[model samples]
Target: MSTTFWIILAGAIATYLTRVGGHLVISRFENIHPRVEAGLNAVPAAVLTTLVAPAVLGAGPAEWAALVVTALVSLRGGLMSMFLAGAAVLIIARQFVG
Candidate 1:
């Protein structure tokens, strides 16, 4: 409706295209290199660690608790599940622990 809204919408579209574009290009390959597949599989854990490191550096008890739960969940779950579990723990703990 506004200039800012249009900018945000355009950014969202561009981001989505960029994210999918990589997969589209990669999917054309009949066989992926093992090293490439390993690198791709590592991306999620690498992303998680980078996101966690800064927060953990200056975090309190609630944040630490959530991070621990997230790490534990990560061993058995996907990124979204671990994130949601961590968020829920953080929110609930913050209400009391913080």
Candidate 2:
């Protein structure tokens, strides 16, 4: 095999081993502390906000408008309303502007 192929294969093997090792090591820790578990659970919301905040704030007027519309719709209803609001806002913005 070529040098490139060998390098890629080695990288894949290393990645797989690291993931397997992590699972094995973590599983051996019989009891997770409650505070640590709570912290881990909060991570998802933190990550979601971190990713969404920048785009909603930094992007131009169109994105800001869409974010506001989505928030209002979501508050009124729920996830379904949020999805519809985003799609409608995006379609309208694209049609009118672009």
Candidate 3:
């Protein structure tokens, strides 16, 4: 309808096609190469570090506390639980730190 709308629609379609194309290509391979598999396995951590590293540089005590809680919770809890715990700690810590 609008230029912004068309741009967003184009982006969405491109993202979906890229994802499906990757899956289709991977599925065609009977056995993945060890180096390729290792690179793929590292994707999650690399993505996570990219997301967190910039924030870490400017984070304050509340953020640090939340990060510590999140890390500790992640060791024993599922993703949802760890997220909730970290969110709760961040909220609580902000009250005092602020």
Estimate TM-scores for all models: 0.58, 0.60, 0.82
lDDT of each: 0.94, 0.82, 0.95
lDDT of 2 by residue, 23-66 (tens): 79769999888998888789789989998887767776666667
In candidate 3, what are the lDDT values of residues 5-91, reduced to their tens digit? 999999999999988987898989999999999998998899989999999889999999999999999999999999999999999
Candidate 2 collision pairs: none
Model 2 lDDT, full chain set: 0.82
lDDT of 3: 0.95
What's the C-alpha lDDT at position 64 in model 3?
A: 93
| Model 1 residue 30 CA deviation in Å | 3.2
- Give stretches of model 1 more than 4 Å off: 1-3, 69-97
Ranking by TM-score: 3, 2, 1
Sort by lDDT, top down from the best: 3, 1, 2
Which number leads on TM-score?
3
Q: Predicted candidate 2: what Cα RMSD to the true structure?
A: 4.7
